[model samples]
Target: MSNLIHFKRDELSFQPYSGQPPERASICRLIGPDASSSMGAGLACFDGCSIEWTVLYDELIVVLEGHFRLRVGERVIEATPGDVIWVPERTPLAYEGDQARVFYALYSVDWQARNA
Candidate 1:
């Protein structure tokens, strides 16, 4: 069994996307991938911004706070606190958020996902 890891917003390692001033932070302490399948729980912070997303893996997103619109191909999803979204691998998506918006996300790759 793994011990629980705790974290607050801003504690994760930030990944800087091209052309966008770093909008993502990786929360390794609280969650991360494993041999069976890697899982992660992290918070994303955004401001009036837009960025292209090509899903790296499967994801389950829960809005912890703030609001935004998810643009995936031809579909648009309105997301707010308590909203939940499922994203498949290789999907294209982008986000436009209000000032200081944050979303709590749960993600895992195919291999690890099966271990659950």
Candidate 2:
């Protein structure tokens, strides 16, 4: 018996991000607390949008398509396909993109509950 999970991008069902306009962003969570207590992973898509956020867990984001940008205060980080960005916990940042897709993995699958 094997306990392995596999997901295809085309088969992912994305939901509108609650904090953003539905037309601007969507997210598909691939792994969470139910799967792993220490880590979480997901895919996000953005269409000419920007999202302000404060991370509760350390995260690594890999750009899959189009252009992606991260604004941490006065510093701006830009990424294209095959690029990776690391964000530490407690960082206040803005995610910006123009038709971009990214894969992200974060420490602490239950960050929301823990932070709350």
Candidate 3:
């Protein structure tokens, strides 16, 4: 790629996610490998936030607004603003919050694959 891509808040596009995510969810597309593949920013309801487990290939979650309880395998991670959580491949992870929380993440895989 051309030294990757640069995106300003205003230069980004805001779009809602599909799936059963909270209605409060907002995402900004920063980089997309193609029209069907992407990596972006997301904000969702923490309380109503789905505790749906995810098996990440290589992912990192950085809290920006609030705190949440994170479950990864036998370990529980208490994450708050400024806290960064890293989940490696094959690890089942889930997040819980009393209310909605905002977060930034670096997703290096194809979220469309829906790996179990």
lDDT leaderboard ranking: 2, 1, 3
- List, residue by residue over 1-116, the lDDT tens digit for candidate 2: 75789897579998887577766898999999999878999999888888899999999999999999999999999899999999999999998888999999999889999988
For candidate 2, what is the TM-score? 0.94
**Local error of candidate 1 at 103, Å?**
3.9
List TM-score per model, in order.
0.67, 0.94, 0.60
- Candidates in order have lDDT scores of 0.61, 0.91, 0.58
Candidate 1 C-alpha lDDT tens digits along 1-116:
76655556455665543456664322232455643255665556566677677767777777666776778988888888878888887688986666434544445534344544
Q: State in Å the error of residue 29, model 2.
A: 0.4
Clashing pairs in 3: 46-100, 47-99
Best by TM-score: 2
Q: What's the lDDT for candidate 1?
A: 0.61
> Model 2 clash pairs?
none
Candidate 1: how many backbone clashes? 4
Name model 2 segments beyond 4 Å from true: none
The digit string of per-residue lDDT tens for model 3 on 1-116 reads 44655466466555554354545344555444463244544444465454656645566667777567778677778877777777776677766665535555545547556553
Maximum-lDDT candidate:
2
Q: Which regions of candidate 3 fall more than 4 Å away from where they truly are? A: 1-29, 35-45, 99-107, 111-116
Candidate 2 lDDT (Cα, whole model)? 0.91
Point out where model 1 deviates above 4 Å.
8-19, 22-30, 33-37, 104-116
